[model samples]
Target chain A: MTETGEPEIDLLSHYARSLGIEVSGFEDGVPVLCVSGIDAIEGRPGHFHGGATSGLMETAAYALLRLALHERGEQAQLKPINITVQFLAAAKKEPLFAKARITKLGRRSANVTVEAWQEERDRPRASAVMNVMIARSEPEAT
Target chain B: MEKEAPHRDPANVFDPEKAAPFLFAGGHPGWLGLTYLGHGEDWTEIRLPWREELMGDDVRRVIASGPIFSMLDMGGGIAIWTRARRFVPIATLDMRVDYQRPAGERADVIARCECYRTTRSAAFVRGIAHDGDPDDPVATMAAVYMTIGDFNPAGAKND
Candidate 1:
């Protein structure tokens, strides 16, 4: 966990894990996320769904920002203010992977960049940028 | 290509089977589907069945903007889904849509999407839609996705 300042394990990552999003590893300012095809929350064919995809994008960005904050010993509610996604290709197989990077981290706001890819990195299936708002966690920690 | 009949019933309007490749279930209202028609590696065609519930009073006379956007979003999502994985939940982080023409009741919405490139974590995609001609696109979109979890078809509890 290394001493980043804030409490270890960003709350949002815990929620994402509860929802079944698996975190492979985080290093060099990059957070990696993966999900299998069979475990997809939505979709009818051997393809993924868009709304669900949007949810994933949000999750990845959220996780990256949280990790950055943890490293800085800062705690806050990370809410998405805006997001922009680009669908590059279809995810054909199972076990998709997503990587996230924080483009800019500010006191009240942050911007994150993430990409979803399957198999190889040469071609990405989708990519996104998310703008998030930082606020105090309600109720204060016990 | 088979011509899709305009559905009068909002509840039965979205066909999961027809829109199978692209449709995704689960949302506040629940039961949502989007379809893509015609196909090419770099380009494609799409269509979204009209439903009354997704329409607005002003757009009621025409197809609502939200549904149209949903269709484009779904179409673009499906375009990417076809390449990397099968039947996994994916979510959109953000989307931008350019509406060129107003969707009418009788006229069905259509689109074409392209996946240019992708990295380990994200994919980049682009698409366009039209009523009849590709030259006159009714809508256009660029989107991003986050891939998470396995299909777990039986929805079984892991040991």
Candidate 2:
């Protein structure tokens, strides 16, 4: 188990690793993760696959949630309840970046908002809202 | 019957039956081993078989929502082409997926999506992800896509 200095994420997660997501760094206490546009993730020629965009956003949100949980000393396993995403623009061949923050951490659940961009952070390629149920037990590999 | 189908020719109109292998044969969908189930005039179905790599919740042993999300997106896009009867590049403007229950519990998650409406540049889709019964769906999906350039058969895709 990692401490609370940085967002403690399981780097060995198959799905997250499969997407090639890596922690770039932190900004304003939030972790900004990134994934490259490799051939394994291409969609419709030059555009990012809708699902790939969603996955990145969702993974970023969970990383934030994990950080929040660790700060509270809560070993909660997260289960996604819903996710709504808006694709503002078509994502191109640039490296995709995403960051998220906890909107609300209730007793039984938590809400997170995430944004993804390619180059300019201000011009987000997509944004997402995710809600997950918190299982207050030993956190599993997400 | 699966591998014997002819290669997809870009010149023809869309047919999910013929295009399934081509679309899902590689890239993200193929990497996940998503299967093409069947299709109607306005809808298409695809399945995600269980794999250890697909596990999202290691404790609950559930397939991650991300793969399911991809399955829905692919199925929804194909449904639109099935309705349009032609291939056209489209962008996902927005999509919302609601998990009514948990799926991929050492089983399979199948997505059935229908393109119910299409304007000049936008298409709307709705569908469900279920283990076996559509009535008892694990998740529901709603999405809209904006077609690039002219949406006719002879038009070109914008990027």
What are the lDDT scores of the predictions, listed in order?
A: 0.57, 0.82
CAPRI band for model 1: incorrect
Error of 2 at B151 (Å): 3.1
TM-score of 1: 0.48
Minimum summed lDDT over a 10-residue window in model 1 chain B is located at: B1-10
Clashes of each: 68, 0
lDDT of 1 by residue, A1-142 (tens): 6565323574234324433567666656556777665433444345665544545556777767767777777657654455566767766637777887878888788878888888888788888776677775555678
DockQ for all candidate structures vs. native: 0.07, 0.52
Encode model 2's per-residue lDDT on A13-120: one tens digit a residue. Answer: 467777787878778777898889876666766667888888889889888887778778878878889999999988885699999988899989998999999878
Q: Write the per-residue lDDT of candidate 1 for residues B1-159, one digit (tens) a residue.
A: 112322212223233334454233333112333544555443445566655444333213555444555566666655654543333345555577655556666566776777565444455777776777778876677766555543233443221
Instruction: Please identify model 2 stretches exceeding 4 Å from their true place.
Output: A1-12, A138-142, B1-11, B152-159
lDDT for model 1: 0.57
lDDT of the structure predicted as candidate 2: 0.82
